[model samples]
Target: MTRSELLNDLEQSLTRLVDGMLVDKGRSIEFLTRLDRLDDIAIDMARGINADARLAGFFADNTPWLLDEDLTTAQKGRAGTLFAEITDLLAARTDEEGLKLGREAEEWSRAMGGRPLRLVLRATREEASLSDRFHALLRREAEEVNMLLAEREHLMTCLDDVLSSAELKRDRMHHHLAASLIYFLKMEGYKVEPYVRRLRRITEILEKEKPC
Candidate 1:
């Protein structure tokens, strides 16, 4: 074959390979986007749970001491308003609505004699619950991502085997890309580990003792 003809054939082959890679990348991106949306919803649910947990804990912690005092009608009104504000925020899905409610709750809590120490303790309890729920979802997602990674790896491995049998050089490029994708998922899974461990520890302690 003439040199020009050989070059032309090679160019066509590379073009087709690039097109296939683009298609695969598009599929991967779409799948990951869906995963991202699921993650966002899980986070929002966990946040709502955290908000409600905080309000409940605040009342539990302070109602004892506050009830001992002869609270004014205005003080009682503000406390009820704070509780309602927190409840509203817990029910809110939109960030704007939640933020507005959060601000109102903060103001009401302050006006109703919320102490910083009590607030901190209540916040910790809320955060613990949020972490617990988030970790549960995270573990499930991790397993899903791991399964996806394994599937992709298996497919890529098969592709590599086929390409090797056919003596195709392009398979090397695909194998490289597949490995990179797997590494990215592993990195993300690693990022979620600490929270999972925290949740596990909390669960262990809770199981060991009964709530009074």
Candidate 2:
């Protein structure tokens, strides 16, 4: 079944189970709050998956240009190293790592001057002095690297938020299902197993989409 259909089924089943319970009003409120939290986490997880897919596509498309053989060996090596470092930093999703990588990338870009850099620098040659052209190339590359670093940082933040939310929901769900209410529902002949099963399936899907 589609995700929306599964979510609807789960919500309806939970609603029915909650309605049949003889719990106090406070307990009912807690159950509903947990349900809402789970739903929000699921939705955010899906959004994060979609965002990661787009970022992967972006990297795939742009990476080859940086690896082009026309660029100098040093330029290509730096580009490859930066890509690797950025990927690792993004996976870790720490601001400190990102800032360190950003500084390294900026320094590398400034020192890098090859065919691609020369081409761009030559374009504005008429408008710039020799020293200005040199600085211009450095600035251009620095700006590009900074933009990429910012994008990676933003994507990593989104990924970290989704992962944390998913973990929180998982713990909450475990606690909620282990409560006496779940036992009461099962004793009443309610089919609550399917809800848990569906949730597991959704978690598996998210796992497959997770970044390496």
Candidate 3:
């Protein structure tokens, strides 16, 4: 395939990847919110009970009406199922395992910041470098990507702080983390569009040039 055709294909693939990531991110936020809400309800229900048995007995004695009161019928059903799944997950995981998973998630979010554009540029570096204007444009795009990466890193750090804090309630922590992720994605996604446009421009210029 021609260089322009290759870049166009790559851009389309990356766009699809970005869309998928956004959808996954939305679902992840929803999952975390549900878990946090359940945790809050469990904590409330466990009041005056022994600390160790609280989580274990959360859904044991009787299903709490609190969930029904607070959630829609569909949400209540989903929450019940999710609670069971979370119980199984907690049973299977040690504190260390849980911490490791949290760290992995944070690392994955950090790594995702500028990866799509970086991969595209790396794949087409030779053709992009052929024209000084295109090369300079790529540099500018890289700088913009870095700026977005820095912003996302800062937001992610704020999210980590919220997650790590003992003072914040589960509900507050969930809101903060969800807002931070959505904001980070919004700002980061904005950067991708411009970079994609610049890439298309570079490809168009390359297409117009005769082979040496």
Error of 3 at 120 (Å): 58
- For model 1, name the residue pairs that clash: none
**Global lDDT of each model?**
0.43, 0.42, 0.42
lDDT of 2 by residue, 1-212 (tens): 99999999999999988876634445434433432332333234323432334334434454444334444343344343333333322343456644554354344334433122222344455655455434533543343233334334543332333334444554332233323233555677765574445445547755676669
Candidate 3 overall lDDT versus native:
0.42
Give a tens-digit lDDT track for model 1, residues 1-212: 89999999999999999999997677555444433332333334434444434344444455453453444343344343333334333444457645654554565546655322122124577796566444433433334334344435643343333233223222222233333434554565534343334334444544555346
How badly does each model clash, as a count of residue pairs?
A: 0, 0, 0
Error of 1 at 185 (Å): 14
Clashing pairs in 2: none
Ranking according to lDDT, highest score first: 1, 2, 3
Candidate 3 clash pair list? none
Give lDDT tens digits, candidate 3, residues 1-212: 99999999999999999999897567545544544555565334323222234443433432343323433333333344334323323333467644443343233223322121122344466664345324433433333233334334565443443433313453332333334444565677633343334334444544555257
Q: Considering TM-score, where higher is better, how would the candidates rank from best to worst?
A: 1, 3, 2
